[model samples]
Target: MMAGEKNPASCYLDERTFRLCCRLFLQHSETIQDGWSWEQIKGTDEGFMKKTVLIPVQSSVMHKQHGCFMQAENMDHLTDDIQSNVEDETAGVQAVCEIHAVLRYEYHVLYSCSYQIPVLYFRASTLDGNPLSLEEVWSNVHPNYRQRLQQGPWDTLTQQVMCVTS
Candidate 1:
């Protein structure tokens, strides 16, 4: 049986049988990893204004497969900076505030891809879940790349040659 599968009611009636079935399923599933859990970095008082809460989960696969560890402290620092700015007198409170921060872990076996690339993507918003602008988001990026990212042809690739084959 697969994780999240709906088993027959009769099979679940016996506690021992149900436990056995769960154990079997867990032992066979590729997605199941030990010690995976979520932790909240910020409280409601922080500028998060969204109804949806954010939680960060530590992922072993991300480290083992991608050769990269998702730094929880980096995300925490970003949230903390935003919170401090809000509390400061110079930066007045906005109509929307950050309410939650979450991290998600996903495991997949892609046969077509040769390398496992660990990509870190972040979304920031008002409590209502509306996304912040690039400027707002880049405020969290390292200063050296901030200016370059804003005005560079980062996404555009130069074509080295055009080829014609007979």
Candidate 2:
């Protein structure tokens, strides 16, 4: 394993710790319970076993709006040219939002991983206690990316275990 990678055993042990954290958050805050679980793709090849857990966040909503300066357009003659230009600008803004969201999510994961915690999770609320759907959490993503996730393999597992609590 790398110097900072978590061992597989730690992942199993930390499951309870993570669950407790989730329960605490659920009790006190609007914690979203969505995560990715996967075995290390190259564990045996490396010295120690490693595993990864990824938690989604709604915090991306803020990151999605940064540095978005809208240019003022003329009010006269709103022809096809003007409409096309406006659409192009909006598309660029959407692209920027998507990139910002993905980068922010990655940075958060890296920062959380630096703590040497076997289970890394993201907390986004203080009290609302509202559950977030995957579509809502990933709302900033591009249509194609969102569509792919909506139809991804995890969707099947989520549906199958919708009623099972953490």
Best by TM-score: 1
Worst 10 residues of 1 by lDDT: 45-54
Best by lDDT: 1
lDDT of each: 0.36, 0.35
Every model's TM-score: 0.24, 0.21
Model 1 residue 77 CA deviation (Å) reads 14
lDDT of 2 by residue, 28-94 (tens): 4333422222223364421111222222223434333332222124112222232334323343434
Report RMSD (Å) for each prediction in the order shown.
19.1, 17.5
Number of clashing residue pairs, candidate 2? 2
What are the runs in model 2 whose C-alpha is more than 4 Å off?
2-4, 13-19, 30-145, 154-166
